[model samples]
Target: KRSCTHRYCFAVCIKQDQRSRHARGTVPTSKERGVREEQIVKKIFATMVGSSSSWSTALVKISPYTFASIGIAISIGVSVLGAAWGIYITGSSLIGAAIKAPRITSKNLISVIFCEAVAIYGVIVAIILQTKLESVPSSRIYDPESLRAGYAIFASGIIVGFANLVCGLCVGIIGSSCALSDAQNSSLFVKILVIEIFGSALGLFGVIVGIIMSAQATWPSKG
Candidate 1:
């Protein structure tokens, strides 16, 4: 009889232990596990959705004025650098050639003028961009219109800057060649000058395009 009673008590203790484990969630049932997995999936989905929206909002919050300023700086800075580079290369060649043929001095000045014009193109584009920049209220800084305007202005500046930079280098190299050729044979001066004129026109093309691109970029007003 005592053995039977002991066996029954042991069974009751095992059952209690099992019940406690289930109640404490140490052993989750299939249904409970599925519910947990669903909750985890929902949380992950919510997190992914939140992160995606935050990325877009962060992009939109970027200051348009900052990009515009950088654009303007690049346009002027790169154009000036190109012009200076061209002038340096051409001037050295021009001075050397002039020493051989003094008569070509005045005529070869055209090349220098063309190089200088590249810098002017940058300045013109920069001015246009500057004018397009307006003081906007804090509320409009993240507006879609403002973002569009900023991007347009930045693109315009980049287009003008790079075009002028290339144009300047082309003119300078060609100008140097022209000076040397003129010293050797005066007839080559006009032919080479024609090519230089075409090279200079490349910068003009950039200016026109930049102007057109920035034309529609207007900052939104508070009103």
Candidate 2:
């Protein structure tokens, strides 16, 4: 009976040890499960917030094509305005002076025509600029880099238009300053013609150079 009691005590101790081990293991597993659930909730919340912000931003984004087209249209309009004003001021002044002078002299005709040519030149240049700008690849139209270039071209167009306007004004003033006696003298006519021709030529050359420089300098943005 004493041996049986000893065996029973040993078996009871072994069963208690197994139960203790199971309980200890379960505590760590439950803690790990809780940590995993918290991480999942945090990730879901962050994703939801990020998605909402992106949707809001997308609504404000401008299309590149639309921006470029609007810029081109404005540029062309400015050119037209400058050109029309230049023609009216210079051409009308010349006609009025010729009528008052009552002279159908070659010098008068040449002077009138030279002053009038600025408007025609401006139109031609504007057309060329429009053509060049329009020919730019459609694929590149909306690119940030290309739009930057377009802006530069627009700026150049503005400068050229202004220069032409100034040139026209100067020619008109020269015409108005002329006297009937000055027109009769061939030597004086030659001298004045030289100066006028050189000035108008320089203005035309500058416009071309400005366009070329702007086109070359303007680079596409790599957004």
Candidate 3:
């Protein structure tokens, strides 16, 4: 009887120890869950930090000077593209007219030279517009704070750049055609001298437009 009672007491002690261990394990698991919840809350707060900021409000805060500068730049691009396409149309028509005419003459040469100059004027306008935009301070330019103003400036630049590009193409074609005519008609020696001047004018126009377009395109809008 004594031995049987001793064995029973030992088994009861072991069961009690196991129960205590299980109870302790439950506490650690609960602590771990709490720790995970804390981490998740921290992450959520970090993610939502920027959600309350007003983008439109920031856009409204943009400066008027910045808007004007960028708008002008874009306008220059549009102007260039417009002039280019226009010149191309006019020049192509002129070429067709020249082909149907009796023959290449001094009168035709003079007309062609003047017609080509119109495209050069377009380039000149683009250059002036671009230079104006470039002179503006970087701080005045658009950034995230001035989203509306910034985008507007960028749009203007794009318009002017494209317009200038088209204008250049038109001038080139017209100038080439004029020179070829002068070359084919050897009798117009005096007119050949004028061709050089016209060609130089085209070259100058191209250079000015190119410089302005580059400046407008490189200027940053958003940060």
Q: Tens digit of lDDT per residue, candidate 3, span 1-223?
A: 9667655655665456457767888433666656755655555445545334466666556664566565565555455454555455445654665575535444445544543444455455545544544333567445443443344345544544454455455544554455455446646535554654554354345445545443444343333
Candidate 1 contains a number of clashing pairs equal to 0
Clashes per prediction?
0, 3, 19
lDDT of 1: 0.87
Model 1 lDDT at residue 189: 89
Candidate 2, 103-209: lDDT as tens digits: 53445555556555666655565565555444346556556666565555555666666666666666655554443435355356556666667656645764776
Per residue, candidate 1 scores C-alpha lDDT tens digits across 80-142 of: 988998998899999998887999889999899999999999998999899999888987897
The residue ranges of model 1 lying beyond 4 angstroms of the native Cα positions read: 1-58
Query: What is the C-alpha local distance difference test score of each model?
Result: 0.87, 0.55, 0.50
- Predicted model with the maximum lDDT: 1
List where candidate 2 sits over 4 angstroms from the true fold. Answer: 1-101, 134-142, 179-187, 217-223
Model 3, residue 64: what's the lDDT?
44
**Which should have the higher TM-score, number 1 or number 2?**
1
lDDT for residue 123 in candidate 1, whole number 0-100: 96
